[model samples]
Target: MKRLFILIAVGLMSTAAFSQTKTDGVHIYNPEANAMADLKAATEKAAKANKHVLVQVGGNWCTWCIAFHQLVDTTVVLKQAINENYEYVLVNWDKDHHNDEAMKYLGFPNRFGYPVFVVLDGKGKVLHIENSSYLETDEPGANGKKKVGHDVKKISSFLKGWTVAAVNPETYKSK
Candidate 1:
């Protein structure tokens, strides 16, 4: 009986591990991508739009990264803000650690955590390395325990703060 129980536990653990590697559902992380070219394309798009490039670094294996992508997809205002101010790109950081050159160029921002953000100007200059954890809020749950999740308002503010319009010379000139 003990052996059977151990087998069952091992099977469950394996299932969980296998699930983590699967990208059958909605996932933004693509570990096999050529991130440098993607970033260049996004920068070009940003230049055309007169916006900045927001690079999201993480792998599909990260639950928080998935959650962040889902939040952006579902939240109307947040999506609009991103659409207006930035050309978004998702760069994969998997077990193989692909895109090392791109990550190195961006100063290795994955040191913060999964789902870290880096904003680049249209000219491809790094402007900010945003830690997504700072955009999350800890609220009390129904069970009276703290639960951390994305705060839409905080993310919107972050987007707005890093936008081209926000950094324009005219805005600074008045001050």
Candidate 2:
């Protein structure tokens, strides 16, 4: 019984550490960071990867924002798609409106609500402004409870739709 208790305690501690390990600014959603700087950095990275920049605008205060983050972090296919095709940037929309200036440049995505998204091409041009609500599903949970989170298939499709595939000039032969 004592050994079992020790094992359980170790498991809990490891799980706690795993979750909190991503609390750094780059991983956790920070409201105080310069959103424009982050956008610029993401744009550069996306350009190098030939991927789009996915800017998620939201605050840590919002439950749905947290839920969306968790969904993307844990879902393997969704996470893989995001990793392979986008540079993810989390822009905060706190009550103090820390990054309002950047939002102005981004066309005020906060108007949609927390956890809205902006997609930018490799060159940093605005491709789309996503209202996250449309990406979610209103289905019953296993316990017959209604839970709000992103639908993996929808997210995968959305990512694929926005992803810019590389072009091989060699393939364009003269007719």
lDDT by residue (1-175, candidate 2, tens digit) is 9999999999999999888534334335766688899999999999998889989988877777877888899999989988998999999887786697788878888888978988888888888888998888778899888756778888888887787763334445677
The candidate that achieves the highest TM-score relative to the unseen native structure: 1
Q: For residue 104, what is the lDDT in candidate 1?
A: 92
Q: lDDT of each prediction vs. the true structure? A: 0.89, 0.82
Estimate TM-scores for all models.
Answer: 0.84, 0.75
On lDDT, the leading prediction is 1
lDDT of 1 by residue, 1-175 (tens): 9999999999999999987644457557767778999999999999998999999998888888888888999999989999988999999998886688999988899999988999999989999999999988778888898766788888988999999989887877754
lDDT score for candidate 1 against the true structure: 0.89
lDDT of 2 at 59: 81
Clashing pairs in 1: none
RMSD of each: 3.6, 8.9
